[model samples]
Target chain A: MNWKRYERASDLNGALTLLDRAEGTGRVIAGGTDLVLQLGQRQKSAELLVDVTGIDELRGLCASGAWIRIGAAVTHREAAASGLLREEAAVLAEGCGMVGSPQIRNIATLMGNVITAQPAADAAVPLTALGAELRVVSAAGERWVPLEEAYRGVGESAIDATREVATEIRFRRPGAGAKTRFFRLARRKALALPVLNGAVCLWRDGDAGRIREARIALGPVAARPFRARQAEACLTSDRITAALLEEAARLAAGEATPRTSLIRGSEEYRRAMIRLYLTRTLWEMLDIG
Target chain B: MDHGVKIRMKVNGQWREAETTPDRLLIDLLREEFGFTGTKKGCGEGECGACTVILNGRPLLACLIPAAKAEGADILTVEGLTPEQGLHPIQQAFQDEGAVQCGYCTPGMVMTAKALIDENPSPTEAEIKRAISGNICRCTGYTKIVAAIVRGAALLRGEAATTPAGVDRERVPQLPPVGPG
Candidate 1:
């Protein structure tokens, strides 16, 4: 009912020790944008909070090697401004920039979004499209999990991030001519949660520029962020064309299992918008915008 | 509900400490404990930027932030904007450009604008809009508020004060188009 202790973890060991001890009674405060609200609303019954914002290893966004490693604690604002993310991962950078606002983005982390496991989380949608891998760590040691396996349900996760820290999310930079885009349809332009959102990424190859591989992710249309495998398959046969985009849109919407909600929209509208936005996202990627 | 966390931080150039429950919000810490109340608490949730503050050089919502997170960080609020001589350029520009109406959102607006101008000496109109999109002001309809921030940038740059900086009348470049949500 009340947080009995607020322990500041200066490093990863200190954080692991405290978390390992608190067990289920502790909540980790990375950006504190979500946890602080949850704590006040009594949504999380943590008697102790282990602040991991100070952990050195849990910070930084580096693109040095094969993969671009984004620290779990890196705030959305930081990601939006980073030259590396802007270049190699502009979809993620733009998505992060769209989250809540400049104020909220200044403190919300990519890992928090990934771990929130929400269907339409701005950061998670792009990370899912990029096939990002999450390094979930605890005192028990380390394990890497694909972003998909981390989700248990909406706002729920199979990974015990309370017991384990999400150290980083990493992915290889897309190759040349590869297109990545994240698009969302919200009620208002600013500070509105997505009514529906999706991200698309495709690898371009051959002199004719055929789509060699593709990944498509859409949210709030399923329990977790739904990957449109059938839609992605629509692109595999040939280079992009009007017919291909139409087929992909149709398949992507058909792949969705959206629930009818009074706030978001009807199930029919969601499916229709998915088709529309999917086309625009593809058009934008092809520079036909 | 009594025994609490002992926390310390520098707020508006003053090093201060406060004892509170682990669930204490940073907005309360500044207003109640530190007594620098220029920052307003509009929404306890992160939805409203009325509770914005600069922590360690980044603007974050104080209401959504726990007090413990302020430890060892340099925080800037509207109270710290004055340097003994006169009002901060931002406050001055806001007044000159008629940015304030109801005045409830002024402090938070000033802080957010301060962060924007500090980071970008002269942001384009679109950049200015993106910077303050987090903060909401109902009274000014945002035109004067945007104009004031542009003027503030000019004042900070020691440029010609005749016209507001960054094209105040210019329509901001459109952001990425959205779909029906």
Candidate 2:
């Protein structure tokens, strides 16, 4: 609730210039659902707010041959309603929908969710599962960073907010006959942040139905959202069965090192849920449920 | 420091400009500056849905929105939903189905319900549950509220609301024509 001068940037270039000049003094505001709330709680402060909601290039989803591009400033509601996202990355859409509530989804941006780097960020798990990349724009130029490399801390991101404005998030769409599912173990039904959310994506490879790739992303368990590579490796063979899924779940459970927070989830409960959700999600994805 | 910033917001249907602090919450502006007090504030945090309003045709928690950020946005509160002519269908349905108990959560519930019906004209019980899941009601276990939304959808469909003798049946807008009736 501290005093700050707010200015609406005309375009992405304007925003980049403002960010470059102000260093840490200016913060980009899009949607403002999270940033405004954080400001009110005194979690973040700035001398100037560069509102970028009106920036055209920073909104909407675009699809190419294999890559799907999601604008950083696209609202969660837009992401939830995107048919391309639903077809290509349904988990991302469903996860975005589950954040906060319908109201928060209307104004909260995907970039904001990614930048917050909260371990419990619902959309982060799916992004990690899809191998999404962060496209950042600064006064100097543009660069791409993998989603996993973007996080540095629980609530901190490696992308310098002072110098960069996240412009796009891109990921490869799963090929033919691929199946993906997003599931979360939240305390309550709506508006509540995830206690421990996860995403599982598997693709078919030839006649054997290989798990071409599997991503086991866990949230609220570490400094940043992470994919359980050991678990993913366990299921990346031609043969995928209930036993293999159980093993993957067991491995995923071991990867998480959850800490106790005001939110009433313990390390024990989260680990259990990770294993439970992994098997359940695997079953649900394979239509063996 | 003169910390207040100038912002323009579309309250109901009118565009009004006001100078407010960068941190001024939306609930305070609705009640104090705009004088439309129908939107209540229960938990200052986003947990409670008492201060729900329609932002860009979608329901959102107004209490969590900063007044400065709502610039040039369309906001529809409970007061905005009702017309000078009469009550909106959601309001009538709440009255008809006896959904209001303490009448505190009604405004937020109405806004949330409006969003649900607007998006999905005939939402299933599960969808309705998901839509209002953010709204917490200490009284009225939400059975009647859900029923009221169903009844309101029927009313909007122009399917004869079956009102009592004294009610006017003409105020509610009719649903758009669809497949052969």
Candidate 3:
């Protein structure tokens, strides 16, 4: 609890002005699920906390044409309950639904999950697969940073929270031919961190029955959310087949770099599970037995 | 800069005000400042739901929320459950089902159940389990807690209460009346 001042920002400009006034010692606090705990544990320090939850511009989930925008204050519970996300971005909804318990979900925002930048963050893994972009606002101006580029390393975010506010996360809605799936392997069903989590967004050609485009995102297997580009390349423009799926799974398993840890288990096990989970996710997406 | 900030919020249907530090947790403000001790502090972190409270119609971990965040928000704690005369239906259901053992997790469990039942009047067994998943009960093993929630739902729906197979309805112990602390 190193905080010396806390101010609630009623709008985006107010937030930026507060941050600019604090210089580099201020940090944005939304949901506070991670930041509060980190501050309590003395893992992080902040001289001022700019509360962004009060800002009206940073609220709700909405759709505009092909893009869906989720404001930074949108909690996991709200996202999970959203009819739009469930129908169009089912993988993101599923990933968010698996985060923590009901209490945690009710207040833990999706942007907070992304900003915390945990490698295996449930929400971030699916957002990565969905190719979401972050709208970051600072005193200079606003910029959209691709979700992949937003991560600096494990537990590190390229967006400086002290000087910037991640306003929203936006991604194009999955088209009619597209389907997505997310799978998480954890110690327990609730209130447990993921040992390994994965998400896949795939589009199939209607007439040709070929894979149109695919994005495979897996986590706790690399420094940040790891995209299996090689694995995705094997499926793109290829006709659907069990053999091809297996080959892609093998490539994905080879691409992962999971570390052996006390909680998540050995690297050998996670690598094997990656192959199995990726295969199952693709199979479920394609309705393959 | 470390001086206390004045914050006003509605707690348990009454408006209350408190001056708190920037880093003071909501749980501390409720228990220490306002004397709403029913909200227990279990893990102090968000891992345990012993400090669960309803904020703006959502059940959230009070320990994780800063006191300043509760400004102008509505909060409901376990102490707010009872009515004018007797125990709340949920509390009565817990008593009938013997849901209280160590009683440490009861406040959180009850608050979580209240939020769930308020949203979904007829929650299934799985829903009840999921609703109270964050609340850790070491004594009851959650079997009675789940049963109590189901029974509480039934009672809330104005249905007649049926006695559990083994428990004697006449011998059920009475809970002390709850009021503003």
Candidate 4:
């Protein structure tokens, strides 16, 4: 790659100005794990590299009222190490930890992963399950979108390229008795991208032990990370049982829309593994493990 | 139209100033400009662990970091493991357990292991596996490497000035000299 001008933005306003004045010739880089690869491959262009790692406002995780807010530039490693995130949004933390190896996780940001918009992205599944919302800012103004609605197409998002940048991700705090689990089946154990994955979040209702609500999200089974609404509906207001779990698993597998890849698995095989994970996750969540 | 940037970074415990293209990768800067060849480059795409190094106490892929953005950051490479007296305990353990074969991946492995020990002094086998999961050693099969790290942890704990130290560096295995005497 050829040399390019580099500008380090110390604050959000400064970054906005740089973005505005670059005449659509600049690209914002946070952590640079993904962008560097894209640049090396000549997959993207940016005459002016706006380094955003210096902005302190985009760097922490906190809870406000009933919602947990995470800065866009916060790294996967940071999220994995957070006590508050692990306590409030266990599934999201676990999913972030599984995104890449420790080194990649140390630098790759949560917002960067979402903005990449790959259907098989590990973090998006959990965020979809949590009903996460995003806060996007621009040189012009700001806007908020429910995380699920942010996906306008495959490899495209609702954020405008000319002015907007992801700023925050917010989601409701899970209740005290709630439990979250993330499951995936890939060719190898570590560092390999997910071919298929799922996240499950369930909360119990009082001592009756009935499932008050369940959110099940699957990745690589659709154009975007999708909720298994049929599976969740089967669990609602019902006592945890093996037959119900099996029915839900079958429904989830039937709901998926996996595409054939050049790798080891076929579309049929991917759907089967999705069924296996869904059943096992439900059983484990009910403490039948 | 672009120009090289003059960025100053603290690499291997020393401040270094270099004029690099804006797109220069930190991995190349470490090996080429700083002459710290201990941080290896493998799968420049960051999928491989050969480029692992410690930046500000956190382990990261050097290949994934832009040279210009690393300004004023503390970077520790495998060359920093040994000063003047002797080899680091982790290096010693790898030698005694025969964890190194081709040697191309040793520097990154050692640095990754160092970060793990810094965080968890007495890590279990599972913890050790998790710590080095980012590092791929296709040659040693990871058995000897994991054992070496466990032994190394004990050695590091012993070297501490505290009375209840966890590692004893004196008893660690001895390895050959590392990174240009």
lDDT by candidate, in order shown:
0.83, 0.82, 0.90, 0.83
- Residue A130 lDDT, candidate 3, scale 0-100: 94
The list of candidate 4 runs beyond 4 A from truth reads B159-181
Instruction: Give DockQ for candidates 1 onward, in order.
Output: 0.54, 0.44, 0.68, 0.62
Cα error, candidate 3, residue A5 (Å) = 1.4
User: Candidate 4's residue-wise lDDT over B41-82, tens digit each?
Assistant: 888988878989999998899998888878889999988877
Candidate 2 displacement at residue B41 in angstroms? 2.0
Cα distance off (Å), candidate 2, residue A75: 1.6
- Model 3 whole-model lDDT (C-alpha atoms): 0.90
What lDDT is reached at residue A179 by model 1? Answer: 75
lDDT of 1 by residue, A105-213 (tens): 8888999888777888889888888999999888889999999888988878877857888889999888666778889899988888899888888887753578888
Query: How do the predictions measure up, each by TM-score?
Result: 0.92, 0.90, 0.95, 0.92
Off by over 4 Å in 2: A260-264, A287-289, B1-4, B162-181
Please state every model's RMSD to the true fold in angstroms: 7.6, 7.5, 4.3, 4.9
Ranking by TM-score: 3, 1, 4, 2
Model 2: lDDT of residue B174: 85
The lowest-lDDT stretch of 10 consecutive residues in candidate 2 chain A is A1-10
Give the alpha carbon lDDT tens digit for every residue of A1-289 in model 2. Answer: 4636666787998888887778788887777767776777788777778877778887768797789988877988889889988987888898998887777777788888899888888888789888899998888888999999999888888887766888889998786666778888777777677887888777777545677777778787888887899999998887777898899999989987886667846778778888998888887777553
Stretch of 10 with least lDDT, candidate 1 chain A: A280-289
Q: Model 3, which residues run further than 4 Å from truth?
A: B162-166, B169-181
